[model samples]
Target chain A: MKRLSEERTKLVFEKLTKYLGDNLKVLIDRPDGTYCFRERKDRVYYVSEKILSLASTVGSDHLVSLGTCFGKFTKSGKFRLHITALNYLAPHAQYKIWVKPSAEQQFLYGHHIAKSGLGRITENTPQYQGIVVFSMNDLPLGFGVTSKSTADCKHADPMSTICFHQADIGEYIRSEDTLL
Target chain B: MDVVNAILEKNVNSNKSISVHKDLELEIDEGTLLASDYNVFDKENLRSSQDTYLKNLTRDNVQVLINKIWMLQTERVDEAIVGILPKPVFVLPRARSVPKPKPLTKWQQFAKEKGITSKKKNKSKVTWDEELEKWIPKYGYKKAKADEQKEWLVEVNDPTKFTNGEDPFTASKTAKREKQAKNELQRLRNLAKAKNVKLPRVGIPSTEHFRDARQLAAATTIARASTASVGKFQSRLPKEKDAKDIASHVPGIKKKRKEAPLSVVQEKQRNKKLAESILRSKSTILHVDAPVPSTKSAKSSNSGGKKKSSKKEGKGAKKPKGGKGKRDLRSKVGGRKRR
Candidate 1:
């Protein structure tokens, strides 16, 4: 079995965040049914995961939901978290992500969790962690492995996609079902 | 009556300097005061109307004042007239009249009375004679008769033949007249020989000798001088040219050339530039500024604006003061046009 290292996961997310720095206003949607986006004051504009998720809803089966994330998150405002997400969609795992405020709940969870006496996540000292959730109906509960994906690099936030090597997941949890 | 008598009698002995009276007016020379009047009109009795001299003067006194005014106007008082006045009187001395004769002397009187004329006469006299065609001898020769005639005949006749004449004039070389005739014949024979010309035996005077002796002598001198100059010039002339050229080379002679000297290009250019410069200067002095196009445009715009504004205002319109009217206003307002 292989487990994903925190350093390797963070490196993948950092490469995606670099594209989304100053020019773009990005949006994301979380699985918990919350929407997140940044809007400009002068121009009417919107970018969101609902728009991104349309790619999947249209029966684009090649779209992968790696259910992994990694990147920087900052609590710079009340009820506001600036998450620089480096996410991946699959079957061809193209990194499409942005660094901006996340979907409403995602932003609240990231912002509230970081500011509630959590360890400092600065530029020099960044958080590197991830979660990999398996399908509960397809697997027997407590029988399937639910080991979180981790990488040692830096900047892990809630919606930041953390990609893992299939062999590394084998190192942490043995999966009897075929790899999706 | 007493005042009248007093004024009439006016002590002519008392005021010796004042002279002449007319229109019952005492015409005093400019400075004499009416002392008698002044004495009667003195300050203590100044207001005594009936008896006082000032009261007695009446309108008659104004004549003297008028005369004084006239004298003041016409005569400029000077120091000489001032010196003539009495001690108390303030005489305004007048400018002197033009000078007159200082009375005649005895000699002038005698001359004037006698009516004398100058004795000196102009002695010069003019005379004319028609037959002689010149003035004949006057006082001097008229008396010296036959002797003078003999000398005149001797001068007019040929020097070689005077034997027909005997009483030879005293004015001539009388003692040597015969000797002169012989010498003249010999001289004429020698002259013929020297010139290689034939001699006439009965020697006659040259026609030139009949002319005035002085004229003949002058002609001979002029001929001699001309001949000498011809010889000298002939010897000095260039051998290359003929007598025609020599004649042309006569002293003081000048020849005219066919063409004048060519002018330098720079000189022509300079003259052209000078002419152009004068033209430019003349034009510049008279150059009036061209009427401004902008003003014309503004004028047209103003007319248009007035028309449009009138249309907007409807019917009862005011015409703009412009064009000739503006010019008239400018002149009337005494504002000089800027241009």
Candidate 2:
């Protein structure tokens, strides 16, 4: 089990701060250099030695194991933000589209929100930009991309579609067997 | 025990004669005492004959039979106890083993050491900023860069704050404007000079040079005079009136002879009769037995027939003459060649 060096953690933290902004803090308490991350052959990030130790101590086996590749680390290596990491980070996301109650089930089922399903979105959010989508109760549903800007939406037809769902917990559950 | 004794005494006193009856009656009457009787009376005899009768039964079989009997007794006791006691509700135990963890690599180990866990918490501890009215991180609230914040702000111009100010580059702008105007004026003057400078005529001389305005006026007068003469000639020539007009004008021409104005019913009847006559004529032509009238006779018959029939013959005659004329010309040319 390898641990990330202080230098590597700083590098990752800096990149995360730039990419995710305030959302980075939700993922890490602080860049204390105690956390360990494994880089897979496909460039995905995963919790390795530290999580294994935690698992042994906690006596629990269920754990999130994969993180998505976020931004370029070097010309060759890339930094990835884990999908599970987004669970903590979603609340801190600056841009968000709050989905309607009627669209909650469809959103969890990994269907993109139709224009009408866009109940409330962060003001001044740009079009084609990545945004977090939440349910009416403010439970983060998943990540999505805005199809139209807030200004475009003001004059847009009510029936026009708006956001595209990227990933969700429901998709993870449905694909758990295949993921393994 | 008392019931068994009473039954035994009754059986013994009632049946004293037959020994078989007495034995059978005793066996039947003493149900509780049967096992004791087997143990006490039949034990020695059964032991002696055990080799012969119990050859098929194993120790296991005997033990199983004893256990089955014991179980039945216990089940009866349990049923009685259950009838008196309250029913117990059973619950399944919680699963002891957790789900299997996904395999990790070296880098993940490093990441995990830095307080990273594989199990990401679904609920975020990030607090909502009341002032900002948005969710914020637990620690180290990162305010967006001023430039980024500016980018996110909707662009709006304050019309009320707009002030009419003096032109900042009045001298340069006015000089440039005057220069552009001078250049435009120069271009216009050059275009006028180019237009005024006459170039020698190229290509063939125009025929229009032959006629001056006076010649044109004379030509117009000649054309007018010719048109007037032509109109006078046209007026002097007799104009052929329509047959309906001729009939109306000439007293001798009967209105009935000229087509009378027919009502819809009359027109339909006339059309039907005309169709019947046409059908009769077509049938006559189609039938081999019906003689085809000679050309002269056909013409005379057409003239004698109704005006409609004469009109139909006239149309038919014109079509054949066109073809016949060419044939006649060919024949005449052939005759001349023969001569």
DockQ scores for all predicted structures: 0.00, 0.00
lDDT of 1 by residue, B1-339 (tens): 999788878876445432323344344444454422221334555555545545435333555554454555343376333223334455556689767755554445567899965565864433454544555444455534533443454443555644445444542456557667877876666566556778543555577454765555444333333664543443332433222233344432234444443223332343334334443543332222112134344344434333321222110112112233344443422112234
Model 2 chain B lowest lDDT segment of ten: B313-322
Off by over 4 Å in 2: A1-19, A25-33, A41-82, A178-180, B1-339
Q: Which one is best on lDDT?
A: 2
Quality of candidate 1 docking, DockQ: 0.00
Q: For candidate 2, lDDT tens digit of each residue in B1-339?
A: 999999999998766332121122121111121211122334665678887445423332344333333433233474563122223233336579776664444446568789776687686767676756667666444543322343353323434432235332453357669988987865655555546754444576455643665544443333333553432333321553224433343333336543455533443344334434444554343242123234334323322332231122111111112112223433422111121
- The lowest-lDDT stretch of 10 consecutive residues in candidate 1 chain B is B312-321
Docking level of model 1: incorrect
DockQ of 2: 0.00
Candidate 1 deviant stretches above 4 angstroms = A1-180, B11-339
Question: Could you say which candidate leads in TM-score?
Answer: 2
